[model samples]
Target: MEEKVGQLAQIAGVPYESEQSEITGPVAEMGIPRKLLPIAGSVLGVSGAETVKRIQDNYLKENRLGIPLIFMVDVIHGFKTIFPIPLAIGASWDTDLAEESARIAAKEAAVSGVHVTFSPMVDLVRDPRWGRVMETTGEDKYLNERFAESFVRGYQNNNDYSDPYAIAACVKHFAGYGAPEGGRDYNTVDMSERQLREHYLSGYKAGIDEGAELVMTSFNTVDGIPATANKWLLDDVLRKEWGFDGVIITDWASLGETIPHGVAANEKEAAQKGIDATVDMEMMTFTYSNHLEELVEEGSVDEEQVDQAVLRILKLKNKLGLFENPYRTASVSDEGSIVFSEENRQKALEVAENSMVLLKNEQNTLPLVPNEEKIALIGPFGTDENLLGAWSWRGEPNTASQVLESMRKVVNEDNLLYSKGSNIEEITTEQLEEAVQTAEKADTIVLALGEHWEMSGEAASRTNIKLPDAQLQLIKRLSELKKPIVTVLFNGRPLDLNGIEEYSDAILEAWFPGTEGGEAVTNILFGKANPSGKLPMSFPENVGQVPIYYNRFNTGRPYESAPNDKYVSKYLDSSNYPKYDFGYGLSYSDFELSPVQLSKNEMTPGDEITASVTVTNKGERAGKEVVQLYIRDLVGEVVRPLKELKGFKKIHLEAGESEEVTFTVTEDMLRYYHPDQTFRSDAGEFEVFINNSSHTSHTETIVLTNK
Candidate 1:
């Protein structure tokens, strides 16, 4: 591939000695309009297949060194299969489900000619405020490793590109981009080498360990340098330390963002710095065509670098076998056939069924009887087809049924009474009166309201994380109706829901369930499928706890005893406890967890310990429970999280069912990032909890022999 790229470079007649810095502008126009901006050939956005096909036909084919365009998109969660966002999937702790979801996504994405996915974003995010946190698995190296392996397995199936679905996975944000200062998006990240090793970079290593094909650098600068141009991060750490051999893509238009970072004098300089850092792919960003060849001729970018970049790309193309099927999935008919087949919609249903986290149910208010009655479904979002959250590109809003409409599909549509309840953005007196009247005439009210899709992605980050006023007030008003109400929430992050938790009979957290979210919600409501989704981020009571997450080091001055403490990280207005904990979820069926028991409590370095526990379905209905395994590092040189997720298994059982889940604990699963910049676990007493959920982690302590 390198030889091929080299031959192509020679054919282009690019000067071997011209410095990239000396190059000033784009090649003399071939009478093409300078104002016609490029349609993104990479990364998922609104750009359609025809747009990419045009790029392949017009620009790429006529290149001096012809290379076909590789279509890429963000397959962050589940692509078309649309699993819960990475955080929600993380709570499932089901690797098989995670990998299978990715595999389905990869297959569907490939059928559309998308050759690569800027996904399996393995950044270790601890701060909930980072808008992009929804895209990554929760913070913990072991958990991240498990999910990363599943993702790589799903995306890369180790199969040739000719196989129906064979897109390479690109692990993203090369370094500690998740630990931005003040939990602000795109904020500068500064951490000691040891801290970086301990918390953030573990996931990157996990991706590398899984043989990921490509890596995308983060937008934020690590230390002081932008990730796309940081040699220490890209070359010294990623290439030298971990031996990553994949092409590096800049996040969005980060090469140009370097100008904002004040590192580059102009767009050309930023392009040179990024290419000089060996960045091969620029996502949605211009300036590559404007300066790359000129810089190569000026000697700033060596032919070795261009060859290096092209070699990596060609390897991927060859891996995908695009050399033969250049128009893979680009046919107009193929696009028309597989875009949203019934089979795919069923897959979406299965995912939505599994992704719902039953947050709180006071008296099994769920599994609502499929009886014919006057149920007043009152809420601003109840009947909304605005169900499609952010980044939902292809689905037509009217194509799928809304929440109330889906409910009508199962039960008697005539018996189900509906009302607008209130508008999601703002509540008016007329709307309120109509909503209250509807609730007054029903057996129950199903209110659906939450942030719009724009409330949480990119620059849409918010300081206020709660139900929009129109919906909250509507819920309060419906509470006054004295009807049995089930609040179905549609949000991207864990929100403050204490306001209505007491008023509502039940609360269901269904965060942005893709296009078919409404159907999934109704399926669970009508008892067609049980709810098993769980909270992946801590739900702070107020926006004041911006960086809230479940696992964190216990401070020296820990708040103790009283709820209304004056000092020690306590908010004067509210309690420190989050409204919900990480891995927190509820189910119609109840599950009881037994104390964790180790096969051999004490073990030598080479010996393995099997920690096993029993789980019984204490509730009457048959359902699945995610049995969690967590560990606490005792007596460490540096403070460690109160508890870190080590392993989890999702088990299903009938009523009165009991199963023993065994976790094999070896040296690999036991190690943590030490203050010395190496990963190792000091011998001492360890607390192992086999939790029913993240909130209710039941425990047992064991002492090591060497200690």
Candidate 2:
């Protein structure tokens, strides 16, 4: 029983020594006995088939029950052949692409001896100031929910545990981690229960419903209770309400963080609170290993509680077939061929091409003709290899293609020019002069700019979310040349483009597109691939509009944009609208959405109303369009959002071709969490809008009457 309890706690990865060293040194540092090292359930941040096999072989010799250690890693984007980050995938608005990316990541990680991946971070994010927004699917609840299900399915592969390519998926930062105060990471998150249920909890629930094997507690406090020990969230909602029986794990060292959160006095009390909340595992924390047994002995926590947690861990291990083969899918033979395979590289390329958002293309500045016009590629990122964003631990930057190398394939050597205008943060007068000299010889300029890859991940928050001043200065100098300029961005978050936007004729938001990033960008620039991705999150005109999103509630006195209007919810210096609204994207081909048509005016219980629209390609080039559907409740017990995305479809069309897109609106779609906390739909008037983006003005209304 003591061994079982010990298995519920995990320790940091032990150093790999050619000659086996005594475990006492490492184990003692974690405040645990040397004997518990073998019984400890799992290890984090360790990979490689040969090393994993050696560690398991040595641990089994000392383990009394021969239970194997589970190897876990943060394979967030990919293992070796990196793909676009989660936020980029969300911009694609293609659930199939999101799922396929996860499948490829799982296959690569499994071959490298990873048993579990802490990924598919389904936190609903609206604030771009949070550095970790780059890790989420973005602001809308419905969109986040759909991507959540796709990611879970991709990692698990229909829950076939014995498949060598499959790895256990752990959905993370459970419950309101994305709504931290002041857009800071690990900050307190306080909101009404109604607000939490309505906006933030849908994505987590979608992942859980799609059969994710584990749930990770968030770092921030939900209400007054830290998520690591919040009983109402973990026990009442996750376990009892959602009927989730999967293992619950804490984020790295989150269990011990209860002390800093002022919830527990010491490690013993933290472990007790964590177990009482039904958390199955503590990652990289001494709370459980140092005090769980003592708590059980003193009857401060029930013995049965420890037993249940242990059983869940055992079940997960057994499900992975670890008992029969501790090194279940680890293979030195497969590692060479599977990790960063050519097939995987091609998949990464396809996703990167689709994930880029075309924010602007004035005067048809893109789709540049090859060899006809002299092209100058200017910036630090022009030949840089740091395209893979943060959280790519195993991804090799050397494998990524540089922009100059990729453009060389399509353009003649004599016609294509290049220059490193400046570093990502600093610019020299000499460097600016050299860049202008290069631009003077070229007919057009491709100015690559954005935040460094490290500027927007965990602990990488910035108060000012804009391009470096140096980059903007370079843009201003090049704009003075009176030559066509197209800006390609390499950022992780939505950047404020107040100054840069006016100078560039066209702008492409190519978020840290991974591995084959350069090749993907080249395809779009040369007209081989059309840009189709939309903004998953809003782009604020300025940093002051930090938490701006499309689904916000209308103020009592809404700003009417009239000359005489005053004293409303309007900023003195800026407008409430975003610089570029969510779901806004441009392609080579223009698309027009017809007025939304409804099957009927009224709906009843168990009856569905079909909302249909026709999308026509109005341009000469073939392209794709994302038809979006939004709903608004005229009246409710609690105020509702002005507009909420309910459904969307991405369709490809030939030039001048038209297609009909339909969405079935059922009673379940209209339901909301009432004041009494029950999920139900109220009898009221509803408004529906079918358009290309969230800022569309066309709409139709419907009514829902009592059965």
Candidate with maximal TM-score: 2
Question: What TM-score against the true fold does each predicted structure earn?
Answer: 0.90, 0.98
Model 2 Cα lDDT, one tens digit per residue, 514-614: 99999999999989999999999999999998899999987787887453577777888987889999999989998988899999989987788999999
RMSD of 1: 5.2
Error of 1 at 390 (Å): 0.8
Residue 208, model 1, lDDT = 71
User: Which ranges in model 1 have alpha carbons more than 4 Å from their true place?
Assistant: 1-55, 59-61, 78-84, 284-300, 561-569, 705-707
Off by over 4 Å in 2: 16-33, 561-563
Error of 2 at 698 (Å): 2.1
- Give the range where candidate 2 is weakest over 10 consecutive residues by summed lDDT: 15-24
